[model samples]
Target: MTHPFDLSVVDRWSDERTFDVTPDAVHAYADAVGGPSPVFAVVPAMDLVFAVAETAAPADLRTRVVHGQQDLVLHKPLPVGEKVTVRAAVVGLHGKRSGTTATILVRTRDAVGDPLNEQYVTEFYRGVPTDLSVGVAAPRLPSEPPAGPPSAEAAHHLQHDLPSRYADASGDHNPIHLDDEVARAAGLPGVIVHGLASLAIAARTVLAAAGAEEARLARLSCRFTRPIAPGDTLTTRVWADGAGYRFDGLDGSGATVLGAGVAELRA
Candidate 1:
């Protein structure tokens, strides 16, 4: 079947923008995600990685797509109160039985044109069919969990206002995260926490557990397994794996929220 939208834009969809790493932006992210230290002191990873949202994309498709996965490789911590260039392009479009997934490659560079990080954001358009599989897929996480007990474990409470707070800080004002009605209309239970917000929280906990500084984070990746609503308690478990770590997060109901998580620290 022919795809409803143009598939020719696969490798051609590119966007670029400048992002300011303001002190306020950094602080706000820290407040929302529960950290002004470790993984959040220099800059919340999500604030820099999710800068792809500032890039242009098809407006119509935005409403239909849901964040599927994220893979971020950090070169260095972004400097606060400075500007960085963010460039993005649609690198892959693959069709599954239920939908099509678009893989976007986002690159962040310092003001001097030095590389800072590269992130792959995958969006799944449910019920949208496209048979074409083009370009490169995002990096995959480890298939199996490490055996035995977790090396570190921590839990965080998702405050009722966390969604709004994160929205204000991250510039992601999607109603599904702040409006219960809108979320229900979109087929969600109610107002849910932003996936990146939850991911950021998990990263902070993992880093603190490892006793590593924020700047040491070299790569982070995870698959969003389920929606995490405000007021939910998130428990993250991490296992040491050589130079990196593998982790998983569960919500209050013991349902997995993030799976196949990978976080690596630079030696």
Candidate 2:
């Protein structure tokens, strides 16, 4: 189905965010995943969400928005201390009949101005079938919750140089990590790290920690509950249950920053 949309006729969210990446932040996240690190690409993968959210017009655009699907291909592992600036622009748009669904194309970049990733997201806007905005029929929350026992989960950490490389790779150039001056300018104790970067580290945690190869992942989803700064220790713990795994992101102090992480594996 085809719908209607215009960039010049919608809202812009380009200069709306700031961040910091600190030395302490590096240690925290790197320690969580593992001392060294393994390359788990997430640049364009998670960045697509940011790009779509920034470029899309929810108020003016049609409703019935449901996250249809997402995909990401990592070029290489991002190093810590790298600068990343995230900017998203709508590259393409197509519609489903009766406004039943629409696909959006977004591209993200890093601070040094490199193509970090591309995201194509689809939402079912317009033509309301029914008002079931709750329960299994409703959308799920974006934030994850604390994990209970260890059944099935993914665990990982970030390296000291990872933030800098990721910032450049993801186009989420928040100063918290790249610019110390910017970090001081912000009210944070220091530069705050990109939540997606942490999320990426968490995404790999499930695989590396569980000793499962990448091919084991069938489906994965999680919520960004808190912001993480560079140099901080981030530990992702995972557990297995039923046909999938439950996971969570933790701070150096063992605080649950991200929760309700789930991953379905293929047999």
Candidate 3:
């Protein structure tokens, strides 16, 4: 069933949550996705990811859910010392294989109600589904022309906490990415990187793409597409476009891990 929604009501929510921004927090997020370290991005990302899940709608989720895809777009990089409110609405839903798989559309705006970002999140939660035991992506979509070679250097490669250091970085006590026993219970191979952690890397990539010099950079946004495992190597890519630039987060294998990454330039 298509979830018909009033774009207006969703925008003007009866309930709203306020987040006081800290430049440190925003930068930390960006740093995670920027250069790799012990794995800081996962920690910060977990905080936002689950919170966003709740904010989107409690009634729409289930205990068996998994994050299939997530993305963040930005009119501006979330600056420090700004209090922003994320107004999220379920804009669309569709069933491809009779509820075996689907997409959840959500858009979050800044405190003043300006469009901060749009997310095209797809969740696959159903049975009799196609086999994906290998965690390899299934093929779909028409082929597009190859992208031009990236003009910018990789600039940064970051590694957040391995399974060991995640706790100290982001306060996410999620056992799936840290504790081996807990990961077993969750049926995970081992510790996985936090989704937000990966997003943080992407954010930093955007900033770099805008310009390595802090003075020349503008705003940034990202959309999280897939999860980054703890041992994975994160590669940042940027292209020098017109006013700003385009940036993205990629795993070591040269895969497009996140889709719809954006960044703007300063005057």
Candidate 4:
């Protein structure tokens, strides 16, 4: 049977969106992600990435799509109250028996056209099969955890209402992350946390440990390995990997929630 999606329509196709990074927007993100630094200092890494919309896809696949991975490269830290424009293009797509994964390249620029961040966002369409698999995947990171004791560790307690708070802050009102019944219908046990929200929390923990809290973020990437539910405490572990750092998150039962995490900071 042929797949319903054309797949090539979005390939290399691009779109642009413009928005201002107001104080309220920044503060809401920081509060939701549990960032330690002042909310006004620097916008959260994931915030800059998510501010840009993903490249459009078939409407049939939209509801079944979920964030599969995120690879972010920050050229400059966006300050509060900056007007920025984000351009998103579907760079690649891979199909499998399970579903199709579309790799989107998102670029954000300040009002003066200064580069702020570049992100490779992967969206996975569950149970949507396709015979064609083309285009480049996101840049590779270490799949296995570092073989040594973690240099630093931080525990983040996710509140039961975290999903609601994060949904409000990130403008991602997916029912799977809000309504339990909807999540169950989607084959999830209950309302699961947004992948990006968990990623933002883990990124801040890694940054603080590297003592690059105030430094410009060079890169951050992670794959969503497992679902994280609300009211679960996550422990993020970071290891010094040469010049950059390797990290991952584990849930209460010690299952890897986020894997292949990599982060680097500019001097």
Best by lDDT: 1
TM-score of each: 0.90, 0.50, 0.59, 0.89
For model 3, the stretches where C-alpha displacement exceeds 4 angstroms are 1-14, 23-64, 77-79, 98-122, 126-146, 155-175, 181-187, 212-226, 240-249, 253-256, 259-267
> Tens digit of lDDT per residue, candidate 4, span 20-138?
78888877877888863321222333343333323345564566877888888878666568787776656677788998887777777888888887778887888988766666778
Give the per-residue lDDT digits (tens) of candidate 3, residues 29-137: 4443444322221222334444444443334333324455544333444445766655433333333342333333334445678765444444444332332222112
Q: Write the per-residue lDDT of candidate 1 for residues 192-213, one digit (tens) a residue.
A: 9988888899998788778888
The best-first sequence of candidates by lDDT reads 1, 4, 2, 3
lDDT tens per residue, model 2, 1-267: 222344352323344222233444455544543332222333333444445554444554422343333333333233345654444434434343444333343344556666544434444454533222211111243354444677444434445666576666555554566676666654345555555566556667776656666555644555455556666677777776666667778877777766666655667
Query: CA RMSD for every model?
Result: 3.0, 11.1, 7.4, 3.2
Tell me, by TM-score, which candidate is best: 1
Question: What is the overall TM-score of model 1 with all chains considered together?
Answer: 0.90
Error of 3 at 61 (Å): 7.5
Question: Relative to the unseen true structure, what is the C-alpha lDDT of residue 192 in candidate 2, on a scale of 0 to 100?
Answer: 55
Query: Model 3: which ten-residue window has the lowest total lDDT?
Result: 133-142
Question: How accurate locally is residue 92 in candidate 4, as Cα lDDT from 0 to 100?
Answer: 71
Evaluate model 4: give its TM-score.
0.89
Question: Who is ahead in lDDT, 2 or 3?
Answer: 2
* lDDT, candidates in the order shown: 0.78, 0.49, 0.48, 0.76
- Give the C-alpha miss distance for residue 262 in model 2, angstroms: 1.1
Name model 4 segments beyond 4 Å from true.
36-57
